[model samples]
Target: MAIEVASLPLPASADPSKFVDFGKEVKGIDPGNLTDDQFKEIQELLYKHDALLFRDCSLSPEQQYALTKRFDPASENYGHGNNKTGSTVKSILHPDLKTIPRVPQVQLIGNGTVYNHEGLATANLKHPSHTTFHKTQVSQIDEDAGITRYYRWHIDAALYDLSPPKVTTLYGIHVPHGKRQTIRYDDGTGDELEVPLGTTAFVSGKTMFDLLSPELKSLAVRTKVKYAPHPYVWMAPARAMPTGLGIESEGRELPLEELPPWEESKLKVLPVLWKNPVTGNLHFQVHPCGVMELLVEPLPQGAKREGALYPDGAHLTDIKEVRELLYKMQRPAIAPSLVYPHDWKEKDLVLFHNRGVLHSVVGAFTKEQVRAFHQCNLAASDDPTGPTADDIKKYA
Candidate 1:
């Protein structure tokens, strides 16, 4: 089936009182003093912006959990056992510190120069744990040496090899001076982009999934790794460090410890196309992690090639071409209209639909500043078009 891309609607310039009644209920929320119309107005704002930020929320951990429940009834309050014990409630400092705790459900990312330097907050809703396969660090940029470089652009939750995550949220605890720029662009469009602090945008998951080819799908399926579905799946050219890296084939596990050093520098890409089981909307997301190469072509039969191990097989694009394409994609010229930027602030609580939008963190911030936030994921079995319980049980 051919997919049709939807145009993003621009934000309306209206007085706050014009749209909000403040008396209506917002789906599953009960703010006590808020009226049904007021709640509906908030819902409309979130749908329009893909994310909503609240200043001075002053929510306790329990209150945070309650707010999350308004969006996802099955949301959890704390990180799971797979998460590192000390790392969950407390923070971990960087600089030659190895063996940091891994949270099964949540992930800690960023230039880990200090305990609280612009770190990332991530949670795996599909599968939660106390430990994560990926580690957090600042290897890409050497601070003591005064070297500052951004990581490649890609999506999160690509490592699981399963379907990409539907949604993700980032809350800001601190925003430092001279560190207020993060960049993003739309697919196949080389538009330069910028996202200021305290704003959030909804990315389309379908756009990200559409980049996959039949060969890549086969690889993902054969390996049962989840993301690719099979080895035959292929993707368009994208940017990253070193040569292009494909899933190779199914049936092989790329252990974290055994991967090449440069693999850590690669941006992670997910299947760009997806069908929303409920509202039936399409979403596109560009995740940043472990992405190697973008454009790929099948080799001719009986052809001898440098990286080719078999005749009539698939091969990755040349490193130079891949790098050029990546730089072009990274240029701010191709920014997506769907993205909404946010300003970072303390005591802010934001929420959005993961399956419905794509999101990224803004970089170019100083490490001396602290940015912290807590997150939880919600699971729902009531997907309108998802597999039936019997089918899921049979597959299990």
Candidate 2:
């Protein structure tokens, strides 16, 4: 039987035209047990759409891992590595995940304590909130009044040793429902979005690249980003901007000397844009919070240089300068009209292309409001493909 697929429901605020092929809700197939042809067709759909949702699935950690591994057969370790976050106590991610003992590659994430769950006798999960990470947060009064903020906008990657996962699978085992909260951008533009509590907000990296001005596009294709070694630990002392788009430019980042022993050789220097393997589309895929430097190549020879950002090429060492430029390029694509905040239900399985879109955990949950989810993503066997020579020449 042919798979049943339909476009996801977009908010009225979203520009429908831009999301004509962005996300899809696929029904009538059990993802954990797909035939080879079914898996192949699903793979094609996932790349073209970027995010796929399968509702009412009965998936286990073993099944989730199997489904995720099909995307990268050679990969078996978790995206952050098996139990790496638990051991990296200084990392900002330490509090958010609990590895399932039997299925170490699948993590049990979400709020409140879970007992006897998939080989875990007891798991205490904390829902990540802007209050703990953001420099400034809505007051308790405001929070009680239903105001919230985006916890962080990022791709699912360790950004240290492992290559970013190509896809991430999140299965909601227990979903908590509540009134929608208003997301205040708090970046001084007075932006706000009404989203369901704990919704996962997503924005297209393709759209992020597409929205850039010609000059920024020229810069994006020519630039590469250098991530801090042990980035999560490096940024633990830092604070985030009000928008949660990137780090606040304070001198609070941990010094390289203070971070967990890291080698210069292990530091990541990756392209600012990742090329989609199947579709050949370029996605503006930088992790703004972890970036430490920008290595910009000069405009390609014989290409248009008028109004080019770095016609002579430059290595930007100033953290503030690098962050400002990235913010200017990325923030616009996450406006209220461009974001897709999925209202999740129990048994919902969302598969998103980690390289093609940026996503965030949107709100907080009270202790009593338990949310249990099985999250799985494998560190890819290889790094994401950057633009081809033809891509550079065309964009430049």
Question: Candidate 1 at 184: error in angstroms?
Answer: 9.2
Model 1: per-residue lDDT, tens digit, 1-396?
221222222333222332131112123333323455665555455444344545455544344444444544454322222332224222111111122233224333222133422232332111110011112222333322332222322343323223333334344444443433433222233433344432333333443333334333322111111222111112211222211112112223343333323232222233323335443433333232233344332333333344432223333334344334333332221134323444555655556555545444334333444344555433332221332333222211
Any runs in candidate 1 off by more than 4 Å, and if so which? Answer: 1-49, 75-169, 179-191, 194-202, 206-225, 228-272, 276-279, 285-338, 378-396
Error of 2 at 327 (Å): 0.1
lDDT of 1 at 15: 24
TM-score of each: 0.46, 0.99
Clash count (model 1, backbone only): 98
Q: How many residue pairs clash per model?
A: 98, 0
Distance from true position, residue 209, model 1, in Å? 8.5
lDDT agreement with native, every candidate: 0.33, 0.93
Candidate 2 lDDT over 78-112, as tens digits, reads 99889999999999999999998999999999999
